[model samples]
Target chain A: MTETSISLQDIVLHFPKQRNIFGIISDFFRKKIRRFTALSGVNLHIKQGEVVGIIGRNGSGKSTLLRVISGIYPPDEGMVHAAGDISLLAGLGTGFSPHQTGRENALLYGSILGHSEEEMLSKLDEIIEFSELGSFIDEPLRTYSAGMKARLGLAVASAIKPNILLIDEVLGVGDPNFREKSKNKILAMVKGASTVVIVSHSFGLMTDVCDRVVLLDRGKIIAEGDPQTSIKAYYDLEE
Target chain B: MGQNGPTTPVLRQIGVKSNPLLAPINTLKEVRSNRFLVRNLIRRDVRGRYRNAALGYAWTVIEPALLASVYWFLFIMLSGNPDEMYAVWVLLGVIVWGSFSKSLNAATNSLTGNVRTMHLVFFPRSIFPVSGVGANIVVTMMSCLIILPLLYIYELPITIHLVWIPIGVLLAGFMALGFGMMMAPLNCVQRDVQHLIRFITRAGFFVSPVMWTAEMAMERGAWGEAALWNPMVLPITMVRHALEGKSVELPDSIVISSLVVSFLIYVVGTMIFSKYERGAVKYL
Candidate 1:
């Protein structure tokens, strides 16, 4: 068989738009809440080893599309096909549980990321040493400073070496030095990892990392093809 | 959609996704039941608690032991039955009930407790109940070590019937585990169940014949028989009788009914849980 990979067809995803809290308690209780459509008729496909950038605004369904593509959420209506174990880190530490220690959470989170226990163990040292937390690895994660936790989370997941990696604004967390390291590690993986989908509002990073760019707006793909053209379309539209 | 409980039927409405690492193990793949994966989840469930606790796991025994003291004090002292073998009776019930109930109570909310993990992890979510049950049973066995010594000090004669304790324990585990697996899926769908089961579990504690014996229920008339209907009472009674070497046969109706009920619950609960399992992750 040919090395075909991920595919998405006419995907529609809706999420509760309104925050369901009673600001005006006396007005109504158990009222219906509004929904915000995140993705509407989104059709895309990525071949094995293709590096794709998904560019959209905050509410433009960019992250939602990535999450759906990551197999985190089944589209409300659509067909999706992804071949190979997909690993996704939606946020800096989205998968880590606060109650668990860094050492244990690594295995727990690593397993979910699709690594077996032996796979995680063999890479555990690199993960910890990269995080540079040293003895703090034993501390309960809730106690870790936000930055420390981010380092730990990023290190463990990067060590996983996923086949298809979905990264969503992960480099937004740390300082310049850490961001450089993060970008280097990610770029290195691009050669080995079969497919990668990165979502960022920053056109610069999109240009730097992705082979092709797809611009999304209000849940629909408005323009897709060249990195520069999509960037021009995104900025010109904003203008 | 669910009828009586939270079950998300995974209807393959469309095409298969390409995930080489985690293709749904349709019939068991090359993996040899990663012993470490199993150990990590279970170890996390166990050491996760004891790691930061001041009392450590000793609280496992101290917990039921403390409850035993209060019950024995109330029954033997206040009830003016100091001569009665109530302490050992309470200890025995505490031991067996401690094992299964700790697991059941933990398992009941295992899904809710690990909502984050469940949403993220792809390994069988059933591992939560299994791990919780396993962890509680370990602690229960440890408490039994304390209870066994106490049993000797109380001069209770050991007998062959105690060999059946493991069987009864296993049955009790099934009963609790079945209920737990069913509740896990339900907790995922309904947000309120976590709070609701708290009072219900407390009520369950009193009616379970844990602190007191079923014999005293006689004065309560039909209420006494009604108490036996509580599914938790039967396994403990069987195990308690077996452990005490009390020559007694359980009523045929109860034995047949409970085993069947436990079996149905176990099978149907697992079915329901797996059904909704995927949907929960989707919604989350």
Candidate 2:
């Protein structure tokens, strides 16, 4: 039997409507809830070293699917199984406090990603070198520009080699040179024997890096197969 | 996709378990596994609190000291000095109340404050409240050091009962943590919960023996017995009794019952938090 790195069976997710105090109290007393489904009847599986790309329009549940696979959001109905440690680079500079120095934020982010302080400290030099923040690493994150923040985020996230790496639109970061460096970093990660699931809007990047691509629309998979075919199908649907 | 090659077991499950008993254990296990994260969070919180302050760490001591002095002046002016030891009594109450309120306030807002981090990664959401409690505990210890000299200056008689202070602090911490855990998740869902907690804690100071003595309540007969149910009463009274070298006025039954209630609150809080933890991010 081929070792499966990640699998999902008929996964579904729903979110309740945002409410004020009055709404919550009423909902509590009425014993009823209204929710909007984000995903439905989603089934997927990845082999140990497969690199899959998920392409979808805005609010099409691409991020939600990654969250479910990473065990952040519980599916309303369905089963999800992911083996090994998974790292999610969802948003820019997650777990980073503006008041904290870059070094401290890196340590904090590393801990949030499940690395011990000592482990992070040992990787500190490499992370700093990779991000190329140089002397500014000691400065508070508030001092960094937008691209600088994204570099630190990417640097800390990529420092540790995760068994499963889930990327959500992080490729659209930094200026040209830094973007090239980050893309290379991602390519190197994909070269390893690790399962990767990436969500992005960049069709060229998806087709270039992903072995396969899945096209999603309105919370359901519409087409999935070779990157070239899926990308074309996605554009055809858009047209 | 239909070629199920010996269906592999999924690493994590999405649905909630029916067994309520297992919830607390699972929550504890999650928190324990993330102890490093919790420690770093606590460190960040404590440092963050005093980050830009000119006085820095001294603010931990100065704030409580200033508060105690203000209460001392107000109470002495209103009711006249009760005894030579009134300052010590007031300082003790201030320390106890400060720890409890600081912890509750921090923990109540913990989830809301860390909403960004919660969305970006997955850890035990309980860690926010738990680390809030830890940060307060560290600050409380620093404040207690300031009070130690006052006790010595007053030449308060030392006794074996002094040991009860730590126990009291510990019980108070657990009670605050329980309340925090219960409120943290709710606060994420409803912004009103934090406001409500603030109101309750503000009103709690008057209801509990923070500025008054338990003897004042004991004089109320049956009302006094009802007052002991507040949970803070026992610990506050214990710390006062320990420092004053007085006999424990709270009966054994009452103490045991209070301990059991605090424990139950903690367990119930964990269960409630775990129940809503996954949903909390959505609300955030």
Candidate 3:
């Protein structure tokens, strides 16, 4: 039996339309709800250590697929499986508190990524050095520029080695130097005996990093296999 | 609790430890990740709120100090011959009850403001509310440190009864965290819940005895007398009584009942928060 690192068979996700203030207050009084699904039916299976990439236009269920696989959103319609622990780093730095210093946030963000205090402490110097945040590390992240924040976030996420790392367009962060560091870190992570599933629109990023690519359109898979073929097929479909 | 949740003989709450949609721990994990997050959050809240160069740490004490002065000006100075004991009562209630209500109110809004984090990662969502209380406690403590010196400067006698302050503060934290957490997932799905918290917390400001005396509350008949039966009222009263060097008078039943209420809130809040915290993220 080929070992599968993560599996999703006929998965579906739905989100309800948001409520305005009036609706929310009424909800408190009435307490009624009905959810809407975002993904109709999706099927995917990733083998161990596979660098599978998911590509699609906006709202094409690429994020939903990754979320379901990483166990963020449970599929209403199908079975999802992972052989071992699964860690998701979907949007780097999204989990950070804005008013906190980067150094302190490193511990909080690191914990969010499943690192214990000791592990976070041990890796603190390494994380700070890797991100090259320097003196700004002691300042609240609200003080950092967007790119600086992204670098800090990515650094924290990468510090914790997840068994099945899920990336969602995080490669397009920071300036040239920081982006290079992030890419190298990603490459190093991919080389480990762990699976990675990335969702990105950048054909170069997907082809350069992914072993194979799956194209998604309108919440369904349009093509799969070689990155070049998938890219060409996606472009053809778009045309 | 799952394999990743804490295994402490005692835990703060379930969702704070594990849930299938979030951290998904079952007790054995005993890893203190969320606690670490809470500590950082509390530290950051205290540090960031005070780090402004103009007033710096004095900012922590300023608001309460201003309120106290204004209150003293109106009630004591205007009336003439104000007792030190009454000032102590006002100080205690102002600090403790204000902190508790603020924590709960702010906690109800924690999940909303951090929607970016809420959408990207899953942990016991209860931690958001807990972080709010934790921050409140840190801020409250810093303010209290400043308040005590003011008491000494003002010539109010310090007593051993001051030791009870920590316990009183803890109970307040538990109460706010319990209620805030119960309302958190609901707030995430419903924005008006935040507004409702504002309305009610303001109402709480008047009813919570923060600015009033327990003797006054007792004089109001069934509703007021009936409330010393309510757990929060007794504690608020106790804080005032303790600060004034009065005997710590609390009915055993009230203590037990308040603890029970706090526990129930923690239980129900965890169950409800876990049921919906993951699902609520999509709405955000």
Best by TM-score: 2
Interface RMSD to the true structure, each candidate: 10.6, 6.2, 7.9
Give the lowest summed-lDDT range of ten residues in model 3 chain B.
B8-17
lDDT of 2 at A180: 93
Each model's fnat?
Answer: 0.15, 0.48, 0.31
lDDT of 2: 0.80
In model 3, which runs have C-alpha deviations exceeding 4 angstroms? A18-36, A95-102, A134-145, B1-33, B76-82, B150-160, B219-223, B244-247
How does the DockQ of candidate 2 come out?
Answer: 0.46
Question: What TM-scores do the predictions have?
Answer: 0.81, 0.91, 0.85
Backbone collision count in every prediction? 10, 1, 10
Task: Judging by lDDT, tell me the better candidate of 2 and 3.
Answer: 2
Candidate 2 lDDT, tens digit per residue, B1-284? 11223444345553334355566677678778888888778777787888878999898888877887898899888988577666666777788887898888888898888877776677667788888888888877777677577668868787888788877877888888888888887787788888988888888888888777777777889987778777888888898888777655787777888888889988988777777767776777
DockQ scores for all predicted structures: 0.27, 0.46, 0.36
DockQ order of candidates, best first?
2, 3, 1
**What are the runs in model 1 whose C-alpha is more than 4 Å off?**
A15-36, A92-102, A135-144, A172-175, A237-239, B1-35, B82-84, B95-105, B118-123, B156-170, B214-223, B245-249, B277-284
Q: Which residue pairs overlap in candidate 3's backbone?
A: A13-A38, A14-A37, A14-A38, B1-B25, B1-B26, B2-B25, B2-B26, B3-B26, B5-B25, B6-B30
Candidate 1 on A1-239: residue-level lDDT in tens? 22556778899887644332232232245465445688899888877668899887778888767667665566778888776666676555545656778998888766656577677888899998888789989877888887788787788778865556787777755667776787787677665576788887778878887888999999999999878989899888787
Which residue window of length 10 is worst by lDDT in model 1 chain B? B1-10
> Each prediction's Cα lDDT score?
0.69, 0.80, 0.71
Please, what are the lDDT tens digits per residue for candidate 2 over residues A1-239?
35788889999888877456677677788898766789989999888778899998898899989988877787878898877777787786776777788898888888988787777988899999988899999998889999988999888888877777888887768999999999898878766526789898888888888889998888999998999999888889889
- The prediction achieving the highest lDDT against the true structure is 2
User: For candidate 3, what is the TM-score?
Assistant: 0.85
